[model samples]
Target: MRIGLYATGQAGLEGIVEDIAAAERLGLDSAFLPQLTAWDALTVAALAGPRVPRIGLGTAVVRTYAQHPLALAGQALTAQAATGGRLTLGIGPSHREIVEGGYGLSYDRPARHVREYLQALRPLLRGESTDFRGETLSVSGTVDVPGAEPPPVLVSALGPVLLGIAGELADGTVTVWAGPEVLGEYVVPKITDAAKRAGRPAPRVVASAMLSVTADPDRVRADIRGRFGTAGEFASYRRLLRQQGKAGLEDTVAAGDEDFVAATVARFAAAGVTDLLVSPVGTDEERERTLAFAARLR
Candidate 1:
């Protein structure tokens, strides 16, 4: 399995580039940047792409509602060109709370929204024109970046309908806050089956997990719960936790000593995860330890 480091991109732009460079130096396969209250992920990719020559760079996800397909496709192609085709465009219709409450955008029929979004976005990324008119979206245009290859696209999908849309329209799915049991029984099968039915290549299953290697697993789990309890309240995450027989976000954390942590990561691979993004959590010491350990996995 390909291993990636989840660089939150919480650091400033230059710091973010340094982080990716650091990951690449550690022999990691890729660096994934998240889009939340930080530098724009794609923009950062454009700036940092040339600096980190060997590693794959991707967005854990960029919110689909914020940018039109034409606009997003243009930016994605540009990033691909800058990165020499090392970009993976992960897009999602974020939660209703963030979309409706934060951005004041309609969060209606998200599955349909994403399906339509991909229908318009994918062709544009391939330097082809699109004339699409769906109930939720209507777009006509082409986005071209000279000498740029279309980057692979992934969707952040959890539920069945969205998974169907992801397998049908996108290259793969990137998942967060889900455990191995959920990946094996629900996520992998659904997406893979959809891809097979569509006569597409095997879909990539990229799972992101909170990673910590420590002598005290309980303390790390508590810290994860305290910091991320709100994720448990999100309906989509709640269902995923339940599928994994977890009551809350704390229960879903993969924290342990080195041997145990290694075993947990292997479980994800056994569950058919094509890529694993390890997000270092807890203190500065713990984060560094986790980063070093995950780097060694490469």
Candidate 2:
């Protein structure tokens, strides 16, 4: 399986872009930049695309409700053109809390919204002038971007309904935080079946697993806390971890000996993880070292 690092892109804009450049030189496959408190995913993709041509660029998952389909498709086209077709667009309807509470957007009928959004967005990305109106989206005119190749669109699918929408509309599925049993038993099958039922070819399921690594296990755990305690301990992820046999854990990180870390990663691969995105969950040094180790594994 292919392996690489995942960064939160918090280290300043210029600094983060430079870091990505450095990582590309290190022979990393790709980088996934999250759209958290940061700017929109397309903004970061545009900023980073010109710097690295060999590496793949993708929005981990951009919030669907955050922008109109035309606007999103336009940004995607610009990023794809800027990157010379190296961009992968990962879009999603984020959770209810984040949508309704954080962004103050309606969180109802997310599956329907995703379908409607893609229906409008895909044609525009293809440079096809058309009018589309659905329950959750409406597009009157085309986004005119000459000679733009639409980047492969991936969907963030968790529930089955969303998985069906993802398979029908997207080229791949981007996963997160799911452990071995959960991925093998629930996530993968749902994605595969959804694609098959739609008569679409099998879509790639890229599973991004978070890890905290160091020479010392104790220090590694501390690093995880310092880097991810505020973010990783989100209630929803905690519950998911529990469902994956890591219940009551303060953290879901790889912080033990080589045997331990290797065992964890191997389990993910064995569980059918095609692309392994190792999110370093500690000090920058620890993060780099983890990437080095990940390279060794690759």
In lDDT terms, which candidate is top? 1
**What tens digits encode model 1's per-residue C-alpha lDDT throughout 81-122?**
999989999999988888898899999898889999999898
Q: Candidate 1: where are CA atoms >4 Å away?
A: none
Instruction: Give model 2's TM-score versus the native structure.
Output: 0.91
lDDT of each: 0.89, 0.77
RMSD of each: 1.2, 2.3
TM-score of each: 0.97, 0.91
Writing each residue's lDDT as its tens digit, candidate 2 over 50-150 gives 88888888888888898898888888999888887888888888777688889898888888999999888888889888699898878877887777798
Candidate 2 pairs with clashing backbones: none
Clashes in predicted model 2 = 0
Candidate 1 TM-score, true structure as reference: 0.97
